[model samples]
Target: MRSLADLNKQGVVSFGEVIVDYISNNKDNTSFKQFIGGATVNVAVRLARKGISSTYLTKLGDDEDGVFVKEELVNEAVNMNECSMTTTKKVCKVYVHQNENGDRIFHSYQNPTPNEWLLDSEINSHIFIDTKVTYFGSGTLFHEKSRRTTETILELAENFHQIIAFDTNIRLKRWESAELCKKTIAAFISRAHIVKMAEDELLFLTNTNSVKEGLAVAVKWAIPYLFVTRGKEGAIALHNQQYISTEGLNVTVVDSTGAGDAFMAAVIETFHDKGLPQSKTDLEELLTYANGVGAKAVTKMGAL
Candidate 1:
């Protein structure tokens, strides 16, 4: 296992599904445009764009959609050496519907090979040998195979003493029940050093009515860093018993598909560059920068 000093010199490993996003090009949901997307994929690409070395880890099919996703990641300079390729795993597809305000609504998902995932047996300490941070989302937690894989990776991350960053990018439709989703996410949260979630996600998980109540409930998890993002309104963060807020940047809305992912990337990049902020002032500045990155993401058509 690498020490903290050695890990600081390494890059981030983003693990999750890489899906094809079919975005509705019109308010009537007629025309559509396909983009390489997924929460972790977006974070990996954005980190690469910011000159942060990023390695994407996921199992991809040998099909055309998988090839397209791989090509796009390569184009953005994200490393794929740690990724897996197989013939049995088909790429996941999701339909994104956008309102006039440019906010995205996940309409539906088409997954032909939901059972296929990077097996726990395929994972080893070598994957985290040069990884300073390991980032993931809850999308894979609903599946038994992927869930076990996630657990294996989390164990390796802990053993390596790498920063564990988690995003509760919850999709209710993916889980069998709301209770199961909450239970699974809570288990992961307990293992994470840093956690990012939308304001609504926070509320849902805590079963609270407001952000304050949600934060109050979540602080008990003892996570080192917690961020709650509010679209357009900006974000709030809690660290070391201090709460700090930052206002969102004013940007024209084009598509809100990957805004949260961009925000997560920016925050991770900041942590990569300068270890976790030690003061409330520093944490506020970090959140402010992350807010800007998220705002910029919404000004583009695709998540990248």
Candidate 2:
């Protein structure tokens, strides 16, 4: 395994959308509060907070919401040198509603300039020169232009010999159809070195009723590492065709908006610090720590 010292110079690059989340402040969903949030954004910020060097790559609109997102990333000490700013791209906005149990529900999304995204021609390979791992999700794949850009980045990452981590942070509303969503995600999964998905996502993609069955189907993808996270039930990992599970933490839940992103950050951090797991024991430890990080994220109101 590579030592931490050998990997400290290389950071993780997070590529996806950054949205201004307008969360409901009351049960009626009438009142709202704005927060900088997104799946990949939360992961990048959480990784920075954990003292890991993190770089965020996304195209932001030169608007107030975009400015707010940039300032927040700056406050979190996340590197944004590769991020793009343009007047054509409006920062995406999402409305989050909470149930009685404080679980987040995506009520709606507003994006006036849906087609504008980071273009493949604008992407510079230098961004991955010091990157050990490149992380992305399926949120941006709904757009044709963005999907091409994503493919380009993934190809570049592969050429650079960087670890590719894919988080199937599925937002069904973003895609036109569930069939398309599943097909696109499967294509990406085949290229990932590590894959993370919620238990619900596992069932959706594999059409399985249980985690074990889901793993049995996904194992054919031949991904080096696969994790299925079950909220409050802990998590499960499938490595080398073997499965291991862990119990979730019991904590007072305030909000569950960014829990999964926190878990992804923890997983990436472990890989950065210790390289890939050498044994089942090593994989088990990664799951336990990731579950704890996810549990801790829900104790707060906002993702950051």
Candidate 3:
């Protein structure tokens, strides 16, 4: 018989933004439903929910929302040893719009706060010495200090032979321009061992209108594996030279708040459950599980 204790898994570390997401029901109403968000944060919390320990690295503000975010992390059992709080804070808002069929679209976003101080703290590779994987979001590049911090982590990962994952969570509203975003995203993808992004991010990175053209661009990157989320169309995985796409699940989306994050967390959990796929069939099966995880995530109100 399989012991239940055998199900417990090793923890992972996530580095990047930690934002308070204010999700509105409609474009007209900007008030309702608040949650602790940010792509990597979502991944960490979900992994924790799956019985995995997670060390979160980022800076929070010494404010109400920051306290709320801290409490949420505590409730989820995410390690906050690397997390710090400063004197100031900012909240990011997501105005959501849903199609009649329950597809969520983030119509607008505003992020007036930034965390440059978090990067000032020297990088400590020792803290991640035993972590299962080190995951981060590309949005961290928007700031000079945070960008250096990200690059440093990648460097340490390379030196230590640690697994590194990157999520290209492109929020157009926060970028100065799409071209700059693409340049930075492309650079990060080239260095990551595992990369994940939504279908739209592929389009932006490739500057194309069609998925096929976008894939042509996606495949050129140096990443060992790539995960692309396509909402109702499910997700596709590119490993080695093969591409495997799984059918999307039908779910009534309350909000698309953390669908991609959930998908990435599932991918990590799958890798933890079964070592990173070594064959084409294994990759396909892994992506199918990821799509299912993403679908289930949308049935809720926020990332968690």
Report lDDT (Cα) of residue 304, candidate 3: 77
lDDT of each: 0.88, 0.87, 0.78
Q: Show the lowest summed lDDT stretch of 10 residues, model 2.
A: 1-10
Q: After superposition, how far is residue 95 of candidate 2 from its true place, in Å?
A: 1.0
For residues 10-99, could you state the per-residue lDDT of candidate 2 as single tens digits? 788888999888988877888888888899999898889878888888898788877878888988999987889998778888999977
Distance from true location, Cα of 234 in model 2, Å? 0.6
- Where does model 1 exceed 4 Å of error? 1-7, 100-102
lDDT of 3 by residue, 208-232 (tens): 9988888887777756889989999
lDDT of 1 by residue, 166-204 (tens): 999999989999999999999899888789999999999
Ordered by lDDT, highest first, the candidates read: 1, 2, 3
Better of 1 and 3 by lDDT: 1
Highest lDDT among the candidates is held by which one? Answer: 1
Score candidate 3 by lDDT: 0.78
Better of 1 and 2 by lDDT: 1
Stretches of candidate 2 off by over 4 Å are 1-9, 100-102
Tell me the TM-score of model 1.
Answer: 0.95
